[model samples]
Target: MTIKSGIICYIIGIASAIAQPNPDRPDLCQGAYFTEEEGAKALQTFASTYHDKASWEARASLIRKGIREGMQLPARPQFAPLKPIRHSLRTMDGYTVENVAFESLPGLFVTGNLYRPINATGKAAGILCPHGHAPNQDARFLEQAQQRCATLARMGAVVFVYDMLGYGDSKQCDHKISKALTLQALNGIRSLDFLTSLPEVDTTRIGVSGESGGGTQTFLLTALDSRVKVSVPVVMVSSYFFGGCVCESGMPIHKRPTHQASNVELAALAAPRPMLLISDGKDWTRHTPEVEFPYVQNIYGYYGAKDRVKNVHLPNEGHDYGPSKRAAAYRFLAEYLKLDLNRVLKDGKIDETPNKILTPTDLQVFTSEHPRPADAVVGDEAVLALLN
Candidate 1:
């Protein structure tokens, strides 16, 4: 087919896919809250409300409030004292990985691995690495996740790779249950607190990045928390698709009676602050360059930080946190967080070989021998009650 014909066929296929529902996975490209046309119009309407910095701040405040109310977030609780527990500390070529766990809520434990440079002297920059829904049923132990964290750490940033609710060691609740949006957002905030609490971490230099579903978490946290100085949400943010997963759009975040917003607006709330939107042609983000990027760039323009915002669209790549995606994020983070990129680069390319990808068992924070904490919330009901 000719390029023009190919583009036409792709649009026709998407329309057909939208018309037919897949019983096995109903939410795929569902665009439940708004159609592509409607979403585009909504973004335009939201952007129209902001002209100057003062107007943009007012709009941002309204959007943030809408998110909190729509997600049904409870009062911000004192981040339960980060009684962090560190298990295995494995030293790598230029960094080290510490198997770590901490409580985001009273009984809800957030688990993951913390990576740090071995030759650190004073305070260092910090990065939060949330993972996409990969390894299918399991979310951790992905080589890509490990490699990114390792590379960032070797380049002088303390990185934390955390589990998403039920994934990995955080098996207290099911991944698809209700209140996930609220719980995960809280966990992210607590994760930020944990990262910054470390005396070795500089408070001003902090960042968050993730792909796919994790990208949802990345922007959500960045939108809600000002502590996140830099953000790179990959293969996710789309003007059309709010997010297929419940965790991303399960709540009423996109639909308030008085106002409506999409992930694009949620992401744009990180305006003026440095952010990198990485999209690929194989997924919903295919139109990001033409659609989402311009909308967000206009928002940054309000603060005169348009140059600080960037969009790296890969027409040939698919919807995964592959090497190219990580490279874009690595360069952005290195520049924004002031990390030593030279340490992670060789021959003008990121060297992934330095990372020692550990097995899932090796990275788990709660195992049979170590056992989950006695106070850890046991089932979904119990965990949900904590939020209620």
Candidate 2:
């Protein structure tokens, strides 16, 4: 049988044994679905089927539709007025941090920190920093997350580091709710809108980067939004590993009766645009240099823009967005987004010493003194009701 047919049978066998879909186990397929050699062969088969730009674009269009339908996202509502609240503007050595929050929908709030270069000129490049699934789903307060955003700000970019759904101060719904993917995607899109809306941001020089589950968000947003000129999805793109979180694979985006695709394909949809795939040896992306990277590079080749895509494989590292992974992403963003690299570079290494990492409470958008808005949706059922 063909690879797709065989995989379908495997999935069917698993589903039949369960009798009902497990809400806790949303991923129909994980990284172990194929061995290394099998994944390579599967990618080759998919790539060989698309011979021209038209064919690839046709496939991309279908994948995009599937993603929307699977997520149960309706026609996007009119742009909600971004009622932004900014506080605690602290100026550091080369950059400044401000706690900010804005509404993505009527009552759904997105919260996090915004970092900007102290000496930015006319229109600075904009970068969106989405954090992965940490222990508490904390957004920007993690040292690594703060370090990356602060370093980027020091390098002369306007970076907005926002919370994922039910993370940090966005506690309107549970993090693992069925619609997590839909809400997070919507929040990312709105974050882009909020970023570009800034008078200091250059709309054409926008980029998005995130690691792990956030990496899933990075590519998904880039696939749906053309405004993101560059993408760096770190440690989460795989041919067989359709993400493990409800926020990643909770929906049926990767499979349908007649159509099948993978995160490798979703990521490649950002082709012709600059992209950097950061993979590590211990994660699902360990095979990226062999399987995923080449598959995407092949798509970039179709547009005669092969050089725009790159992969930096850390064969010694694990899944987290550690220091070395951040360095690779830093160089790519500096090169593609036209940010000054020297500010964060010391002896050819990233120097995050200039960043002043704050405690989580410092970045909190709502506290006892500043209460969550009276209109904020509170329970899982209430939040899900908004989508319906």
Candidate 3:
């Protein structure tokens, strides 16, 4: 094609990005929407649009507005009572785990295990552990989830390891429902609410960390809500790709006729606040060390807080929240959240073997004896009605 035609095509692409997205065909930007060179060029273009702190804030505000509007997010609802239920406290090594359930919406329940340090004296830092897409109903029940939460708890953090919608015991709605992105985001906000409400938690030290789809949640929640003071999104931030799941990319947050932003920009919204980006060589985040991290670091530089943002790249690792990833996160959280890492530290290395993994049945919230509340909404349509 001629240079003139190339320019025309570029203009058309820009126009398409800003055009109103169709509801049915929701302007989805999923995995690897751009190649490495293309992603770098996109960041350069975004940089040109914002030179100084004020300009960057203006651009950031547009991105925030775009996310709120494009996601069709409702105004913050006055939270009805979360009506939290807790049972079966099991104390181990240096931490204790309990089954927990709370309502995010009036009838939409969020389920998980709450991990707290054993014999704590003062208010502890609160950490929200949102799980990624695991097979079957094993979202937060995965051993990695158990280990991290338990280990963090042992290190003196009040950790809440919760399920994603339709995962584990959060069965009120299907995970693939329309506006799932919106619901999960809301659930996350409410999870923060629940965490802060605990008398034992220190509200000022709130932090969040997750992998894959959960990593998507980590940044989204941190970006939209300033309540999250520290963020560690493992193996997910990427300029070349938006998230792949409906719960991650089903909404049109990345593209609107008036604005366009990438996941890297969304993650950068955590600027000035401490954040750790954990990336591996096997996924979309493979370019994070060279591409995504520097862009975000530049954004942090705008606030003169470049030291607060960090990137840990593992070229030999794949896309799961395995041991090495967890170790990196633990160190980051300990340093920033002021947790007693020495509790779980053994011979100069993080020791996770003390965490006892429970079976799915043991961690389940609603059993035959304690059934789902009769007032609970049953389907996606019912939950969406409440949100709308």
Q: Using lDDT, give the best candidate's number.
A: 3
Number of the predicted model whose TM-score against the real structure is largest: 3
Cα displacement (angstroms), candidate 3, residue 338, comes to: 0.4
lDDT scores in order: 0.83, 0.83, 0.85
Per-residue lDDT of 50 in model 2: 76
Q: lDDT (0-100) at residue 50 of candidate 1?
A: 70
* Prediction-by-prediction clash tally: 0, 0, 1
Off by over 4 Å in 1: 1-32
Candidate 3 lDDT score at position 137:
50
Tell me the lDDT of candidate 3.
0.85
Model 2 bad stretches (over 4 Å) = 1-37
Q: Which window of ten consecutive residues has the lowest lDDT sum in model 1?
A: 20-29
lDDT of 2: 0.83
Off by over 4 Å in 3: 1-26
TM-score of 3: 0.92
